[model samples]
Target: MVFDASARRRLAPYRMYPYLLMTVEVPSRGITDQWRRTGLARLLAEEIALAT
Candidate 1:
């Protein structure tokens, strides 16, 4: 999925200063493991909350 400039702008508030680009490609198992190992999902949740 991709976000357009406007969408990215909308998320600006939740984003930390000095935006960084990170790309991750992992197997389903790895994704699940990381989901549990780190609170990555919360980051998305927080962004969405701020967008609202």
Candidate 2:
């Protein structure tokens, strides 16, 4: 899946870290919003809460 500019900006901070294990969450109804990931592939999931 691909994210547009707005989504990329919103998620930019999370993508900066590729080593440590972290979680991020963005509010959206899209099915791709949930996953277990690491590195630059990590994105908004069902756990970590972030204020957009």
Candidate 3:
């Protein structure tokens, strides 16, 4: 899913706090495959600046 400008704006304020909730949906058959192939966790960490 592509995060557009409006989505970024909406999420910007959460940057100042810790722990932002997010939901992701993936097809059952592709869940493991996608998790192993993607850098989603890393990407989210970078986006939210979660040091730990």
Candidate 4:
């Protein structure tokens, strides 16, 4: 979370067996309108690339 709670999921990269990156968008006039209520959902994905 580099920026804030707004940056929690938005600015974070998952730390796991196969690390991943993600991006999220917020709606203009819905719950996301309020930074405190942007209850985004979790997803499952496969890793395609990695660097060492």
Best by TM-score: 1
- Least lDDT summed over 10 consecutive residues: which range in candidate 3? 16-25
**Predictions ranked by lDDT, top down?**
1, 3, 2, 4
In order, the Cα lDDT scores of the candidates are 0.50, 0.43, 0.50, 0.30
Q: How accurate is candidate 3 locally (lDDT)?
A: 0.50
lDDT of candidate 2 over 1-52, digit per residue (tens): 9877678667756654442233333223233433434322434331123323
- Model 4: per-residue Cα lDDT over 1-52, one tens digit each: 2345544444334432222122232334343334223211222222112211
List where candidate 1 sits over 4 angstroms from the true fold: 1-9, 12-24, 28-38
For all predicted structures, in order, the TM-scores are: 0.36, 0.31, 0.33, 0.19
Clashes of 2: 0
How far in Å is the alpha carbon of 47 misplaced in model 2? 23
lDDT of 1 by residue, 9-43 (tens): 77676483322222133343355565433454466
Rank candidates by TM-score, best first: 1, 3, 2, 4
Residues 1-52 of candidate 3 have per-residue lDDT tens digits of 8777777767756652332322244344346655433555555567665332
Task: Predict model 1's lDDT versus the native.
Answer: 0.50
Off by over 4 Å in 2: 18-52
Worst 10 contiguous positions by lDDT, candidate 4 = 43-52
Residue 46, model 1: lDDT of: 58
